[model samples]
Target: MLKANLALLFIILPFTWMISGQFLFSNGDKILVIITVIALITTLFKYGFTPFKKNIINNQYIYLLIILSCISVIYNYFHKSDIINIRSVLCVILYFIFIPLNIISTRVITYSTLIGSIGAISFAFWQKNILHLDRAVWQLNAIPYAACCLILMTAAIILCIIYKDKKEILTISILSAVISFYAIILTETRGVLIAVFSIFLCLFVYVFTTKISVKIKITFITILITIGALGIYTTQNRLIHDTVQGFSQYKQGDDLSNTASRLAMWKAALLLIPQQPISGFGDNFEPAIENLYHENKISSQLYNLHLLHFHNQFIDTTVKHGIIGLVLLLLFVFFPFYILKKTEYSKENKFAIFLLTFGIIISGLTDVPLEHKQVFTLYIVFIYLFLKKTHSVK
Candidate 1:
């Protein structure tokens, strides 16, 4: 009975983020989170925490990162720089526990991820066709929703290549990729588009350079690029026109575009970083900006927006959590690369995980993917899932 409950928890964890927001997520995410956490704790008690060896050091960096996160949470709590929510902080800190608690194999991840992708993609179709919604957010935050679509697209592509022998599955995977790519374009999420397209471009180059037959390679490249070109043409205004406009506006010194606004935010955040270089102004964004405004440090443009993060993940963390937070965040992100580099794995698996992680990192340059709960959970889930199976807790 205990084992069965644990298995169920493993299966449901991924979809918590994939289907979040009003349409399908709502209170459903909270319920899933509750059950998963409970199951994790119960299993830990029953198993006596045998996942780890006696004080052995393997993934110490992960522990350090968690400790730093907890410290920041506590520091913000007593100091009251901006605002502090102990409940949420505890949840973030305890996320590490899930790594050790989940004992399921790679197959569990495979099934759960596929189910989550299908549900999310299905939800996207419902929003677009049934509701006739204009942007097709799947009731998710627009930017993050687009990010999810891109991730699903890449996952489908990976499945298509890996399961090439399975004709039915390959066909379904191709269809899924098409739907995801279409949804990504419809949303007009520029940052995620850049990230996803870059990965595909890399893959395109790889296939061309490989030993594959000239005929097959040419056919594959032609089809993929043709569909991608269609998406580009449809999204020309947001993808091309606005970007060109942003550069022009920036040069004219009367910057008013969204890209210009984000660049301004990054500058403003960086300026404030030196003021509280060590500990930071706490996690409350408004209070920090308020202080900047009082001192005439922030411009009226940035002051009005009252952003939580500077649109860039690194600078965002640095402004609120200080240098320590910035370094820890970087380490946490790059640490996975270290594991992936050393691990013995299939090329497809390595490339798939790299696509996911690299896309998130690139997307973070324009958006704080780690700060948002959904994206944050997405990062944590993929990192641990991609960890080597031999990275034993015992």
Candidate 2:
């Protein structure tokens, strides 16, 4: 009973804090920092720092890579001017806290996480519609939250197909998917839409091509067709309008316009690349990028908005951390896919892992999912758990 409760708390706390942090806390809130500290303490107490254990260590290369990354972070913190970015610091610390806690796996964690995610999605929908909050339209502050939830829901669906579980679990998975998709639609985030669509397309193709039973295949095909039709009707008119508006704004070439501002920001980020090509400017690159925009008189209106990071994740990482950072980031992003490929698991498990890994990689391309503490914490915890599970099977 104690173990079950602890497992439930482990899953609930991280996910709950992640979803609620955006709605309840302001940027750089001490509450978030305090929560991180508490999580770190709990993880240490529960997991007991058994880093030398073979299962926890996993691979020597991973240990070296993580150690080096931590070293880089420490070096940046002490030497770099913008090391005081408390949010970034806390995000890194959370990753450290989560990795060990995830060393021990439990079905309680999985079920609790799924339940919590559903509740969060419901809350997000309520916030958007009943409360009529504009910010809630994006659901969470970051598009990646929606993306992560969608990935998990997709995994749950695959589990339902594979396992001979309770009918209620399967129903819950379907409901979670529906809720996640609804939230994603309201975000109006093109990147997330594209990623979700890509995953659906892949799943459709896989189901159609595979040797699954005719009845199952037909059901999947029917669902796919319905989803596709709905997606097209919903996105066509509004997406076209938004694309045209953005393009027109770009053609007008006004620095203050949204389209032109992003272009200018991209240019400013590029300009910083040559100065610190190897490691860029670390966390301070944002202010420097803004200054470059100001100096060029590219987009004073946008620059004056106190924009801290580039809206684009790839550009942001390249400018801030340089090539080394990019490599480490790539490894973190791609490692899951590599592990999935190695797993000789059941088709359902493989499909689920593939979709989850692909969704994360595609989402990371456009948004800095790793920079947000809530998203980062959830992501690291998931990766750690999934990797541990795979290794245990091996």
Candidate 3:
């Protein structure tokens, strides 16, 4: 029981801290990082870390990629004297390396996924009522939150389909899906909505083609019903208002405030890209964006905000780290999907890959979720575990 509890803590700590870091009034990631280190030490001393030795040594390419990315960051650090921002970059490396090294197994991954899903859903609820922070009717950073929930929901759904004796677990997964859908609506992030719809459509097609049990089919419908009901209850008013506003903006051919601002940021980023095209401006891209916005006389509220990132991970990488950085970023995003294709695994394992792919794609479109130390650490652990499990089965 103690070992199980410690293992669970190691799996979920990174994700819990990542979400909390954004919503909590305090610096949640700082506390999470400290806790993670302590947890790592405890688990290592308790479990002896030898279980992961073969997995780590076998998948050396991932290690190499991590090393290369770190080297690029070091190159940038020296070329541009930006020390504070380097913490974000370093956080990515630490999570990528430590998570895979410490916790990558089927049992650990499954436990982590379950716990992480709960933590993410809980944070969504806290953000809505507890935070009470308001902005535009349709503008919210709920995309990352929703995307995270959707990944977990998809995983749960797949597990229910694959596992027979786990009826109670299936019921819990259904409830989780319902709550996740509720949070997704609150986020008002159109990008995430699109991604979720697309993935579900694909899943629907897959399910239709595959030979699934009638019980599983009924369970799927019940899950959808729960999600739909929860979505209505949670966002009935905002949903109507947002829908009308969205349609009106589309009909009028006018960009919504948030969309317009993103366009402006994209343009500003493009302009700066040429200035220092190779290894562009390093981590000083935020200040560069501010200057560009001011020079262009853009009066958007987003322009006034001290933007830390380009709001798009790919563009941000190109602007900060150049082509090499962009390639590394693509590898980190794509390699897992390739591995998923190559490996013969259970439905739950495939679902994990789909979840990771969906999250990373959505995350790339808006805000650098991967840049956050806590979240990236969680991502790394998930990826490592997925690959290791697949390899073992093969």
Error of 3 at 356 (Å): 2.3
lDDT of 1 by residue, 110-199 (tens): 444455566666766777778888663446676776676666677667766666666756676777677778767766788988887787
Over the stretch 127-234, how does candidate 3's per-residue lDDT look in tens digits? 666776552322234544555655555555554554435565556655655555556666665656655555666566656566778776766656555655565566
Question: Could you give candidate 2's per-residue lDDT for residues 91-165 as a string of tens digits?
Answer: 444434454533333443445456645655665667777887775244457365565565555555554554424
Model 1 poorest 10 in a row by lDDT = 81-90
**Residue 287 error for model 3, in Å?**
5.9
Pairs of colliding residues, candidate 1? 51-393, 51-394, 52-393
Among all candidates shown, the one with the greatest lDDT? 1
- Candidate 2 residue 335 Cα shift, in angstroms, is 2.3
Q: Give the lDDT of residue 131 in candidate 1.
A: 86
Q: Sorted by lDDT, highest first, which candidate order results?
A: 1, 2, 3
- Candidate 1: Cα lDDT at 98: 42
TM-score of each: 0.77, 0.76, 0.73
- Model 2: residues with Cα > 4 Å off, grouped in runs: 1-54, 57-65, 78-110, 136-144, 161-168, 235-238, 255-260, 294-297, 338-350, 388-394
